[model samples]
Target: MLTAAAHLGACAGGDPGVGSTNPFESQGNSNSMSGTTQPGSDTDSTPTVGGSMTDSDTSTPTGPGPGSDSDPTGSDPTGGPTTAGTTTLPDPDCVDDDGDLHGEGCNAGPDCDDTSFNSWQSCGTCVDQDGDGFWVGCDQYGPDEPGPDCDDANPDASDGSDCECAVTPDAKASDTCAEGMAGALGVIAEGGVVPPIKGSITGIDNGPGNGQEDWYWVEFPEAMAMGNRPNAGKIAATFAVNPGDPTSPDYRFEVYTACNKPAFEGLAATYGPGTPPAREWEFFDAHSPPNPNPNPNPNYLNNVPWPAKVFIRVIRVANDQSCSEYTLQVSRLPT
Candidate 1:
């Protein structure tokens, strides 16, 4: 399980799979909700570049442009038309009775229950933080998460369109082990961090099950020349959402030294699902940079910046590989 402290200091050293919140905490954000919000005049969540999320109060914008419930052309103080779709901006004196940065809708925001923090009218079904839909599960927030929208506490992110996030071309590739050298998405130098490499697995509907695999090549700096890079580099991967059955993971990936040899061999060969949350369904492995013998033999890579090369192959092992996306992160932390 990824820890909180590790994520807070992520940038100091790269932290990919290590998430921010505690997974062991309470679940069940499953209250059917409705609404939309902007960055907000109150609480704002800053997603760290290192790929961690942290929430805190910041300087309020004058107020949000309008809420999901806003009246596009409605009454304001002057009784003219308003900016929102009938949703009014909060009244100037609309002090938030609840600690949640959101104000009361009566004040022209979405907070119907001003007495409660982050409260919303009960759809009484599933908790949709963005008020997108009732599909996402309460405890789960991963792409595959059945739903709490990852951070259950947060009031923003994801308007809930299944597979709505654009699939970047960089994350796509032919599925095969090309001879012995598959074209990699990119390389990972010492102390480098690859945020999230998303890949889609939309298994064919008719027939012909997949015999496919992904290729990711990472060449770490040599041990002696690692500057401030840590001795070990880590690669972590997890599906965005378990589109089918969360308990039964339909996909898998493994680390390799080359096209044939296993990188984690005796340590850990494959990475896949674990607990319920996709974050918990992770495979995090570390490898030390290859150390070259001081006694120079016929080593052409002696002066090379990166000599420890590893191949990552994401494989479709499940018989029913649903149409879902996966995220892979590689981090060579400074620490």
Candidate 2:
């Protein structure tokens, strides 16, 4: 009865074909089993069953088992969270205001123009206000900075197109001296003084008791107002003369370029004095030597001798009579 009961326990445990059937053999039929046996059944772990290892791929989920591995949704095993689009921030150290990276400085610098800070867009860069071609600073906007002067203090003053001044030309006026007894082209009186004329004691053309004459004189208003001449000789006095009577033997005319008549005392000294005295002429000759008029007609013209301050005189020869009408133009030539 004990042996039969023991055989019954072996059959209840498992099929006995693959292992020793002895109940107390220690190697029971149920215990001698492969890795595929039901749970709680005696079997070696999977590692010892086959010659090769069948490690379950944990990275790829096969089924819903706690120890079984492997992902089911095709998601990357090592992948982290996801992001979208591109980054959009300027590099603080990057001088390039725009990411393009050109110009004087890219990263680690200031923008050339500040008002328009967009680095890649237009309207950015230092500009010359004066148009001198040099940039003012890192930027062209804001306060008026130093550069080419576009507008100076004066609205009309600037370095612009129409503000350039013309340079003076190289030239000078030359000095000059006058000639002897030669008259220059007369310049119209520009409001100066007249020549000196004084003293009256005439008895040459008239015999002592018959004389009354019309006379005139001239002088420069100022020494500085005289015009310059190209030559260096003394200028002579010139007069235009007209005699009214062609047949009056006692009729005569005279003038003195000097300040006064000669020192001699007589009728001749009174009218034809050689050296002029201090104050003024008593009487002097207007006539030059031996008919100074080359064409001695009644209407001929004459050039008088140049008068030194005290060395000139004039005279006229005529019979005893009163003087007649005449016109006289006198002038000093330039020196």
What are the TM-scores, per candidate, against the unseen true structure?
0.33, 0.21
Number of residue pairs clashing in candidate 2, backbone atoms closer than 3 angstroms, sequence gap of 3 or more or interchain: 54
Tens digit of lDDT per residue, candidate 2, span 8-83? Answer: 0001222223444322222223312111111111111111110222433324324445764654534345543223
Worst 10 residues of 1 by lDDT: 3-12
Candidate models: Cα lDDT each:
0.37, 0.27
Evaluated at residue 132, the lDDT of candidate 2 is 40
lDDT of 2 at 328: 30
Error of 2 at 262 (Å): 1.5
Please give the lDDT score for candidate 2: 0.27
Report the C-alpha lDDT of model 1 over 56-164, residue by residue, as the tens digit: 3233224336555554433555545444223333344555665333364333345445554424332233345445432333212234323434323223434344434
Candidate 2 stretches with Cα past 4 Å from truth are 1-211, 225-239, 244-260, 263-316, 319-323
Best candidate (score: lDDT):
1
